[model samples]
Target: MDEQALIPDSQQGDLNAFNRLVLAYQDLAFNIAYRMLGDEARAEECTQEAFFSAYRHLGSYRGGSFKAWVLRMVTNACYDELRRRKRRPVIPLEPLNDTDEEIESPAWLASSDPSPEEVVHLKELDTAIDHCLSTLLPDFRSVVILVDVQNMEYEEVSSILKSPLGTIKSRLARARQKMRDCLQGFEELLPSEYRHEQEGK
Candidate 1:
């Protein structure tokens, strides 16, 4: 059955239909939570809470896009988790004598014969991205993630975020500019072929 059929069925307490919906969206939901929280255990907890909240509130749902509804719930859960973490910060203990060795480069990066200097530059770029994303205001970061990273359209993101379309566009534009500026410092990280392309731009 299509999504429209599934929603009514699941709303009416069809466990199988609901399970199917969960299976279909669980990965996407988890990834959103993980990316937002940057902690695996916290992400899992947020995902579970979001699902349970959706299940409990299923009766309240009226006609609309079910996927978007669930995503809004998941995003809210992540925001709640972020707020709670801010109130009480706890650091995880570090592992000692770790058996796992760090690989010099990811498999995709390893395939290319990048010079060591290039590799270091790339690593710096990656760090710069992480740092900039972390520094973003929560509202702006959420917009960036929903649009740029998750590839959500403006209307869909607006619905999920309960914001105006113009607000979404403005936030997305600002967020992207911030990311661009952050990455600008690592221009040397671009592969030799891409460096020429960048210079031409």
Candidate 2:
């Protein structure tokens, strides 16, 4: 059944309908969480929490983009997680080798069966992008992540953020500019196409 059909069913206490909706949206929600929080474990936690909150508040949802509504919920969860992180910080401890040097290829951070070259490239690009994203203010970061990373339209982003169109436009523009500036420092690590584009600019 379609989402409109599913929404009402879900609102009427249909767990099956809601589970279908969850299957449809779990990836998007988890990706939003990961981009915002930058950790797979925490993102998973936020995604589960967001879904629970959404199911509880499903009745409050009026006619609009259901995807946007779900995204907004996940974003709010990320914000809450961030606040919690501030109140109680936890230090990460990486295993050290005999020389007291951090292991370069820890099993936990490894990808599944990627070619060595591909793994290196992916790691470099991910690190570069994550570093740039980390520098942005949360509002600016959210707009950019929703638009560029999540491939959301301006209208959907405006709805998710509850910001005016003009505000969205301005923030998106500033965020893109900031990202471009930040990325330039890692031009060599970027893919050739992106490196060429940067060089042209």
Top candidate on TM-score is 2
Give me the displacement of residue 151 in model 1, in angstroms.
1.2
For model 2, residues 94-179, the per-residue Cα lDDT tens digits are: 65767999967666434333334434454587776776787677888889999999888899999998999899899999999988
Residue 19 Cα positional deviation in candidate 2, in Å, after optimal superposition: 0.3
Give candidate 1's error at residue 140 in angstroms.
1.1
Clashes of 2: 0
- Each candidate structure's TM-score, on Cα atoms with residue i matched to residue i, is 0.76, 0.82
lDDT of 1 by residue, 121-180 (tens): 557654445455655667788888888778989999999889999999999999888876
Off by over 4 Å in 2: 92-123, 197-201
lDDT of 2: 0.84
Q: Kindly report which residue pairs in candidate 1 clash with one another.
A: none
